[model samples]
Target: MAYLGVDIGTSSSKGVLVDASGTVIATAVRAHTVSRPRPGHVEMDPEVWWREFRDITRELLSGHLGGPDAKGGAGPASGASGGSSPTGVGVGRPGPVAAVGISGMGPCVALADGASRPLRPAVLYGVDTRAVAQIARLDAELGRPAVLDRCGSVLSTQAVGPKVAWVAEHEPEVFAAARRLFMPSSFLVHRLTGAYVLDHHAASQSVPFYDTGAEDWYRPWVDAVWPHMELPELRWPGDRAGTVTAKAAAATGLAPGTPVLTGTVDAWAEAVSVGATRPGDLMLMYGTTMFLIATVTRQLRVPELWSTVGAYSGTRSLAGGMATSGAVTEWLRGLFGAADRAVLLAEAEQSGVGARGLAMLPYFAGERTPIADPDARGVIAGLTLEHTRGDLYRAALEATAHGVRHNVEAMRRAGAAIERVVAVGGGTRGGLWTRIVSDVTGLPQDIPTVTVGAAYGAARLAAAHLEGEAATAAWNPVRDRCVPDPAAGAAYDGLHRLYRELYPATRDTVHALARLRREAAGTEDAASGGAPS
Candidate 1:
């Protein structure tokens, strides 16, 4: 039997089929778009996500349906013990997916009916900054100390609580109609099994409403934020959320009553995929955003980083994220009007490390974790007329690395003993980018050969659970590792100090400019009879 893992990402949905021995048999990916109707707002239609998921599943499962072991070598597509392939639920049939697991990009919250269909477009995590007002309200109501103690970090627009408050105040129609609220993974699980449940890893994003130390929901914060909304029952990753219902089976071409495991946030699953599961294992996700999840034995509350319950039970993790990573690269590429991504990458590599002394702050999408500021803006310092596009691109890459250093230092302050870094995501494929991050951070980075991020990890999780082995033991896979060059490290050590000063030195300046820009935009919107939602 094989296990299926699905990842609901911000820009796409990817799936992987893994065998008991950890070999991936099939992989599928489907892309979708994020809409930005107004500045600082990002949204996606939920129905679009559901449709893409259906298409990809059918595409992956169709070939194996009629197998005579369907090896694609001798005969037509027929099952090993098949008579034109049995369509109904049975062992070895395409219908009975042994076990299924899920992962998603999160800190997002969506309202769903009792049936689990989203009542409105999901308020995306990190990308959407409409909850700034709500965050201020939450900060005032909960008091700084209470929020910091409970959440291990100050409240920010990125947290789910503020998003919930946004829905309550702005879109009261959808908020009033909501039966329950859930993050991305929980929403996916609900659609699969008709159950409203959440995994603890994703639940951490809902803080101020969850107690990381107690590993349970904190009632007081919930009452203060929204007295009427009900939070879902939470479980650790790999626990059972529910069985596949008839409707879900029909929708996704799976068997009825299939086991569905409660899953985790995409970053946690990415950690699993990279073999960063044990204490001191650090998983660094390089994607639209930069996320660092380090496994540790104890929960810590640091000034900048967040300490949260780990994906698995009886452990803890220190989490930090930068609002933009690869996204900044994409933005710069567009500004440069590069013909293709390959062109940009090729130029970036040839430009060499440190971007030829160009420095970029990579705060284009605001900042999260370590310092929860939504008004933060990107800055390009040390640019000169002689700088080529390649130098600028390389600078953009190093800026992200510098951001990684900041997060790692914050995690260290939280008492996380991060010795090794396992890097995953499409960005890692850029050789120079990976090496620069290693050089900047002074840490060895392990790069797996088959790095598909969260979806691949979710499949591994499913394989372990279905095969009845210790899920943790069964999911470890190692490939190549990158060690830091001492000479480059010394250079970056000085550069990092300069990188650290750039944020504080220019934060207020950027804020002042951002205020002016927003005021001018608001005036235009008022003249135009208000902005779109």
Candidate 2:
């Protein structure tokens, strides 16, 4: 029987079907829009996500994934009986998707009623920082070290508990209405089955609600922070949550009664997709934002970066986030008025190593990871008329690399022993983008054969949890590896030094300016007794 993996990403949701032997049989995608009604606020209708999943699942089951090059219905590399290559394989395999696994962007808190209907739009993970005030309040009340010792790090806007606290403080109505607080996967699983479960990786960041050391919920801590809300049951990522309900089956085109495995965060699933299970293997996810996750033997707590429970059981991970990476690249692409990615890539390649002396600080979406500053803004310097679109494009790429360097250095400082990186996102599709990152960081990267991101990884996790089997053998293999050029590496080292200086030189100044602006807004709000914060 084949396993189905679903990834509920920030910008889209994708599903993939893989056999027990790790061969991808079918793949389908459904895109959704992120609504930004106000500055710094992002949301999505939970129903929209369900619809996308339904469409994608139906598309895949209807033979859309069985291209001409695919194995004659049996899927690639899966040995059929007698090695005869079974015909009409995919045609009859839709109903028997052995297990379903899911993963998505997280560290988010979704407020839901007892029946699992989302009370309000999900308070997104790092993408939405509306919990800043709540983060400050929790840190003050819980003590920084107190939380770090228990949950692996101090609570931030990214933490679910803080977002929960935000609801309690700002929207008490929503808080009172919500019977359960969950993550993306938790909400999805509730829809699939009647279960209210959260996987370990997602649960660990639930701050104060979970005790990482004990690997269970901390009742006292939960009472201390959020006495009003109910936390969900926690389980391993691949553990079966429940069988898909009849209603869910009709909505998603999935078979009724199919087992649904506990889900994980999207970045963790991406890590599994590219064989990044080994200790010290880093996963660089380049999607809406760049998230760096490294699997470590034990958890490491560092102030700047976040240390969380690993995606899979029996391991730990050091994760970091950069507010901008691919976003900046895409933004610059629009600025250049480029018609296609090929032309942009070609232009970026034409420029020299340092983008002809142009440098950029990629804080377009406000920094995360090392700095954790949401107020930070993007900056481009050293631009001149002498520069071309090629130079500007290359600079944008280099800026992203610079951000990665910053994150890597932070992880090193935190005692994360990362030596190899497995690149597993859409960014790896661009040869120049991959090389630039490799050169800038001086780290070789491995790209998997399919690079299906979180969805494929979730499928692998589901495959690993079969009745009885070896986890590693059931997954696909890595295909390509990119190494840094010695010459380019040397050039990037010099640029990286300059990149490091940019933050320190500008941070204090930026903070001061931001404070003044906030004060002015606050003063206006005080006068009106109505203006929103």
- What TM-score, over all chains together, does every model reach? 0.90, 0.89
Clashes in predicted model 2 = 1
Candidate 2 clashes between residue pairs 3 or more apart in a chain or in different chains: 104-266
lDDT of 2 by residue, 397-501 (tens): 898888898899888888888878888888889688888999999899887787889998888888777754365454656678899899989888898888878
Question: Over the full model, what C-alpha lDDT does candidate 1 score relative to the true structure?
Answer: 0.75
User: Lowest lDDT 10-mer window, candidate 2?
Assistant: 524-533
Model 2 stretches astray by more than 4 angstroms: 64-95, 467-474, 512-533
lDDT of 1 by residue, 76-181 (tens): 2222121222222122333336888888878777777656668988878866776777766677888877877877656665578877777787778887777677
Q: Write down the RMSD of candidate 1 (Cα, Å).
A: 6.2
lDDT of 1 at 83: 22
TM-score between model 2 and native: 0.89
